[model samples]
Target chain A: MTYCVGIRLNAGLVFLSDSRTNAGMDHISTYRKMIIYEKTDDRFMVLLSAGNLSISQSVRELLQVEKIDGHEEEGKSGEPITIWNATSMFDAARVLGATVRRVFEQDGRALKQAGIDFNASFIFGGQIKGEAMRMFLVYSAGNFIEATGETCYYQVGESKYGKPILDRVITPATPLNQAAKCALVSMDSTLKSNLSVGLPLDLLVYREGEFSSNDIVCIDDKNPYFKMIHETWGQRLHEVFQGIDDPRWDGGDSAHPMMVRSARYDTMRKITHPGERIV
Target chain B: MTYCVGIRLNAGLVFLSDSRTNAGMDHISTYRKMIIYEKTDDRFMVLLSAGNLSISQSVRELLQVEKIDGHEEEGKSGEPITIWNATSMFDAARVLGATVRRVFEQDGRALKQAGIDFNASFIFGGQIKGEAMRMFLVYSAGNFIEATGETCYYQVGESKYGKPILDRVITPATPLNQAAKCALVSMDSTLKSNLSVGLPLDLLVYREGEFSSNDIVCIDDKNPYFKMIHETWGQRLHEVFQGIDDPRWDGGDSAHPMMVRSARYDTMRKITHPGERIV
Candidate 1:
């Protein structure tokens, strides 16, 4: 299991991934799940993967050389269209999908015969020189969906445990560093609640139009900023929880009371005797 | 989908459940997921359920008359045992499990034939005449596990989004009222993140020694206390988020800096050209 998040904000893009993988609880190991593809002044892309480790590793190995057909114009028929040569992020993602399919073609039947699914998914996002930063959630079936302004982020593997904070905080308008902070906090929640997602995080912040990024770091337990986030977020959450007034059962002079019953439904169904019917 | 939570503390027990059910995104409807059974002055119990609504509803209906065998003393051979007659909460839970098995025997084959799972789960907890407060998480196979002091709560359906708050706030030592507040807060997070879980909540708070509880309420959108929670929690959560310092990318004079990188791993794998191999 793993937890990885990719966010595309108005300011730029944020990519974060945990470095834990497990075959079972007893077989836990650390495996990095993020990869960067950069051509300095030309393009910058990042890929975060989760699911069967073997299949993902295969896809990553194949992705660099994977090519999509028909990109060649008249005289350019021999030129292979790869992630580095694609004109758009969409094209790069298609090549990634093709790479996934190639892995499936090679391993899917064997895995199925052994009673395992060819499970793998990826968050592929970045700029390809001419377009704005784009992000995608690619599925195992060689299909994908793009993230839009209305939902400016994509997450894969063990996503739900850390989702609420992202829902409350992220939007297209979020700033680069703020969104990065939010992603770390979200990862903190996942780390606290799930043993499958551990520390030593890989975080990369890409500023739009840079076509490359220098803000990349691998955070471990000793990292002060992540430590601060882990401690402060929990403490402040407790404070906020305590700050909210508790429900008043008596409906006293309080402006808000818990005694208010719903107008649409009857009181909760109570069965007092063995002969009673619920409806 | 549904979201329901039950918690047992030293002070008492708390149960909260949302009322929404949906077959698909377009077919959403409201159906209460909680039921109470009280034999005033003798016992009080609550049941919160999640999964296939039809199966749960059938189990609830059958549970009224559902009975276990052999509660009879030597001479009372003909006497049957039911939840109403069970002296301890454990015995009552056995009856509940038997009830679930009965439903499974009746409907499992038909549902399987239609390619639908016989999925349903329950959080059952309460105080019986001779027992301390107890709680159990009952699974679809009619097997159950009790909640201990270390892990004093159980949730069923759409559970992960609401779990972090419970992980942060709940324990055996928490007071009944405070646990109830925590349950509502947990439900609030679930509602905010999931559309399949909606308004009109059923909340029940029972004190340790009491056989029945008057602190039962059906809260809807108009409920002020819940409204306060909805507004205040989100606002305070944002404030708490902002209150934490954003990561200092420059490794400046700040006590915490985001630039600290892991010592164990190399910098992220970067593909510089189309011919690059990840391995």
Candidate 2:
């Protein structure tokens, strides 16, 4: 189990991932799930992965050399269609998808024989020189879907516990650092709720139009900013929860009364023995 | 899909369940998943179900007359032991479990043949005369686990999205009203994140030593207290999220700096084409 999230905001793109993997409760290990591929002044792409670690590792190793046939014959001159030479981000993602399919062709059959699912997914997103910043969620079948303006972020693995915050805060117009903050808050919730998602996070903030980024940080338990976030968010949430008024059931003169005569009460299937009226 | 939670607190107990059921995206309907049984001054129990609606409905219908063999000969004098006549909540829960097993014996084989799992669960908790408040999570196979002080609540169906808040808040010492509010907040999070869980909740609050309760509310979309919670919690949560400072990455003289040199940074597995230094 892992938790990884990638966001495409108007200002930039944000990528974060956890590093814990477990085969059983006893056999737990840490493996980096994020890989940063940068060709200076030309392209910057980050691949965040979840699912079977072996399959993802194979995909990543093959991705550097895997090539897809060029969509147009114009760019077909003696050069292999790889991420470094791709003209657009979409083509790079195609190369990534092909790499995943290659891994499936290599291992999918033997994996099925062992009754293990061929489950792996990737959050591949970044920018090339000529194209706008884009993001995609690559599936286990090597197919992919890009994030749109209406849905600007994609999260893979253990997504539900952290989703309410992302749904509430993220937008296309959210600033880069704020989106990063929201991602961290979401990660914090995931960490608190799930044992499989641990700390020592890899956070990358890529500003739009910059082919290379310097906003990469490796956050262990000692990172000051993440420490503040982990402490402040939980404390503040508890404070906010305490500030809310409790429901009063006495039919007292309160601003928000708990017991009101609802029309649906009579139709409810509440059971009681004879000579007892509970509603 | 459904969301139901039962909490055991020192002051009393709180039970809440949503009324949405879905077989597929096109086959969505409303069905109440909670049932209250009261025998004045003797017992007060609420059964909250989630999973295959048919199986649970069958279980609920059968629970009324389902009887188990008495455990002790002193109380086994030609009497059929049922929830209505059980002396302890434990025996009542056993009767409920037997009822579930009976349902499985009736329909489990056909359901399995049709490739549908015999999935069902219930959060059954209440106090019987001379017994303390007890809560049990009855599984499809009729095995059950009781909620102790260490884990004071049980939630079935779509439980993860709403679990972080409850993990942070609930305790055996929490008051009844506050616990009820926490349950509603948890349900709100579930409703916000999942389309399968909808409104029209049934909430019951019972005090210690009271075998019958009138503090039951049928809360639809228009209920004032729920409406206030839906409004205030979202708004205040947004405010709290905004109040937290965004990470500053430029090595600025801030209290929390984003990019700090870490020991693990040197060992990170960042991939890049040659001649580019990203860290």
Candidate 3:
């Protein structure tokens, strides 16, 4: 299991992934899940993957050299085009989908015979020359979907544990650093709630048109920003919880009362003595 | 889909459930999932269920008169006793189990024929004298497990969306009202993160040793405590998020730094040009 997130904001894209993987409670190990593919002054792409370790590894390997027939293959000429040469982000996604299919062609049958599903999910996003930053969620079946404003981000694997904060905070207009913060906050929630995802995180922040920068870090337990986030978020959340008044059942006597007068329903039925039952 | 939670504490037990039910995203309706069976001064039990609605309803209906053999059926005098006369919580649980089995016998076959698994989960908790209070999680096959100090709560259906807060706040020593508050907060998180769960919540809080009380209410959109929670939690969380400074990449002049030299690994490999790739 893993947790990886990719956010495409107006300013740029934020990519983050945990470095832990587990076969079970006893067999846990560190594995980085973020990959960067950049052509300075040309294109910048980041891939965050989650799912079967074997399949993800294969997909990553194939993506480096795989070519989509329509977009990357030679047009009656002897030219090799790949993620390195795709003209648009959509073309890049097509190359990614082809890579996934290549992996499936190689290992999908064997995994199926062994009673395992060839499951994999990816968040691929970046910027290409002359186009706005684009992001996509690619699935195991060699299919993909682009992220739009209505759904401006994509998450994979142990996603639900970290989803609430992202839902509350992220927007297309979020600034680069703020989106990065939101991603880390989301990752912190996942690390707290799930055992399969652990620290030594991989983080990358891309500015919309920069094509590349050195904003990449591998965060372990000792990383200062992550440490601050883990400590402060929990303590502050508790403080906020405490600051909110507890429910008061005394009805009219309290300022923030728990009981409200409503006609839709009454108190739960109460039974007294052996023969009593609420119907 | 549904979300229901029940917690047993030394102070008492708290049960909260949402009423939304859905066959699919397009076919959604409201169906209450909590049932109360109490005999003041003799016994009290509450059932919070999640799973196939029809099976739960059948189990609820059958529990009224369901009985188990070879178990010490409480209160009810006879070879086979029902929930109406169960004297002990254990006996009550057996009757509940019997009720579950009855439902399984009636619908398990037909549902399985349609490829629908006979899935149902229930949290049954309450008190009967001559013994301390107890809570049990009843399963689909009529088997059950009790809640101990280490795990003093149970949740069913769309649960993960609401679990982090509960994991952070709940323990056996938590006060009854505070536990109730925690349950509501958990519910609020679920509501915000999921559309399948909605308002008009049913909440019940029972005090230990007291057979029952009227501390139950249906919370609608306009409920004051809920409104305060909805507003304060979101606002306070935002404030807390804002209080934490965004990651300082250079760490040269920051009060708390993000990047630091580490012994385990260097920075991740970055692809600087189109022809390069990390291996």
**Which candidate number has the best lDDT?**
2
Pairs of colliding residues, candidate 1: none
Give per-residue CA lDDT, model 1, range B1-279, as digits (tens).
Answer: 999999989999999999999998998998989998878778888999999999999999888789788565776764566888888888889989999999999999999999999999999999988789999999999999999989999999999999999999998998888888899888888998888899899988989999887788888898888888888998999999998898888778888876753332266778886444432
TM-score of each: 0.96, 0.96, 0.93
Which residue pairs come into collision in candidate 3? Answer: A271-B38, A272-B40, A273-B39, A273-B40, B74-B87, B75-B87, B76-B85
TM-score of chain A of 3: 0.92
Model 2 residue B226 CA deviation in Å: 1.0
TM-score, structure 2 vs. true: 0.96
What candidate 1 gets wrong by more than 4 Å, as runs, is A72-78, A261-265, A274-279, B71-78, B261-265, B274-279
Question: Which of candidates 1 and 3 reaches a greater DockQ?
Answer: 1
Off by over 4 Å in 2: A72-79, A261-264, A274-279, B72-78, B261-265, B274-279
Q: Summarize candidate 1's per-residue lDDT along A48-83 as a digit string, tens digits.
A: 999999999999999988888845577676466789
Task: List the candidate numbers ranked by DockQ, top first.
Answer: 2, 1, 3
DockQ of each model vs. true complex: 0.63, 0.66, 0.56
Interface RMSD of each: 2.6, 2.0, 2.9
